[model samples]
Target: MVEFERLANEKASEYAYRYLKKNIVGLGFAPNSKICESDIAKKLGLSRTPVREALLELVKNKLVVVYPQRGSFVSKIDYDLVEESRFVRLVLEKAIIDIVCDKPDNRFLEKLEINIRNQKYYLDKENKMNLMQLDNEFHKILFEMANKLQTHELVESISGHFDRLRNLSINTIKDIKTVSDHEKIFEAIKSCDSVKAKELMEIHLSRHKFEEKILREKYSDYFD
Candidate 1:
């Protein structure tokens, strides 16, 4: 009975952490908004202890910041952190693309094409969230093909920040151009033009940096 209780608490903690992280990434929760442990516990129908434990996990991930006397709040977006993450992702992705170039597989290419088709379909429907998810899936498929599991996990763990930024970018940027850029990437990959594919991917990733600048100029209030 005690073991079962412990397992249940552990699962609850995981659930709470996932909920908080998703809400934060999806921008469903405002940055620096006060997050009450008791409120979360009540919402999840769990005890405060498990929710507290989950919050600590979020803090460790830099998704949430806890104040001693005050309550916990979502972490503010840091441009420097986003820039650093972009650099790291670029380096790792370039290496993975190089490997794929050396030994390209049809199966991997097929999967990528399928993801691209799904992305196009979502874009046509203007399903931004699904499009965003499929975009990530396309990159994840590339990394998985390269067998960079650890690097993929690290990128994915911090990808929430990037995801949120992309959400804002999609809202502000020209939709057609963004969709066309993805199409270019898919075409390059299909032709086995690794160099072009890599270049296109770099452009796609850097698009958000441009959006960040525009947001800073036009909507500074939205940022931290």
Candidate 2:
């Protein structure tokens, strides 16, 4: 059964949307699986209306598909769309790294260090979910420091497929290289090496391509 906790001051639809999205991205609601509105509403203790609205929002994000005379289903992982999303994210991340290196704020740099430390902690615990959250927070902090939060939001808004792919990679591949990549990227940024930082960011963002075949072979049904 799916569980949800409503946040104070958050609308029912908004809360439902967030909870549903997290599960979808985490593969809790497996790709191409039917999403029963009434079932979800009952589990979440919400009315069908909010759950319906939440599904509509997910439809806009391309994380869910709706068909006439049928019902909603989790969208299959579209590798092409994932690649496109990665490309856009790479551009934005490189730009942000450039900005970060140009200024190299000590405060934010320390924050990155703490985040990486936390990532290592979570990785040791083999908690992929927390590690994934830390991974995102590391990049989010970079965007915040670079005053590119809106750009980060844009990347995230279109990164549903890529996000799902990443979640799968973290869960299945058992790769710890991501944390190393973050450490190296931090070093480049700390030393104000714009070129090195951008190069590292490109390599970091491009890792999904290398893992694509393996992931597809193992989770064939999850892909489109």
Candidate 3:
């Protein structure tokens, strides 16, 4: 599969885990918000035991902080974690862009074209969440075209903290700019301009650098 799909058959615990993870990473839970297992169990129509297991997994991901008696809370965004993952992602993505630039594939270009189209459509409607998903697919598809999908998965897996930072930073970034940057990278790849593509990809990944301050100031409680 090109993307991570929900399993038609997931155990109760796995279902609870995925459901909570998406909301946490997507900013629905909010930074440092209370994570009430009983409340979540009712909402998900599952028992508290499954929700408890799900929260444990989230804790390992650093998305949830558990304190006995006090209860669990959504963790704050860690800037250092964001930079570390961004470094790994940029190094690998730049390599993939270099490879694709050298051997421009029509199939890959078409896929990106479709992604950019959807990005624009969502941006126009102010559907930021969908736009964010397209943003992820845009880069994941890059690695897929080069058969470096594992690299993308690795970057994504280690990027949970970075993803939260990005979720917060996106509020400060204009959606049109994100779409515009993707367009430039797409054009660079279409023309087989490896240098330009690499350069554009670097800028795309470093957005957190400037937006970090803006996010912290806007949502003071969300930052670590």
TM-scores for all predictions: 0.86, 0.96, 0.91
lDDT of candidate model 2 versus the reference: 0.90
lDDT of 2 by residue, 57-164 (tens): 999999999988899999999989999998999888888888888888889999999999998888867658888899999999999999889988898899999999
Candidate 1 vs candidate 3: the TM-score winner is: 3
Off by over 4 Å in 3: 1-6
Candidate number with greatest lDDT = 2
Please, what are the lDDT tens digits per residue for candidate 3 over residues 67-167?
Answer: 88899999988888888898999899889998888888899899999999998888766447887789899988899889888888788777888887766
All candidates' lDDT scores?
Answer: 0.75, 0.90, 0.84
Off by over 4 Å in 2: none
lDDT per residue as tens, model 1, 1-224 = 00112334458888777777777877777677888889878877788987899889878877788888988998877776677778778888877877777777789888877887787787766547777777778888888888888789998787666776776776566653566776787677667778987898788778876576776776564466
Model 1 spans > 4 angstroms off: 1-10, 124-127, 176-178, 217-219
Model 3 TM-score, all chains together: 0.91
For model 3, where is the 10-residue window of minimal lDDT?
A: 1-10
Q: Tally clashing residue pairs in candidate 3.
A: 0
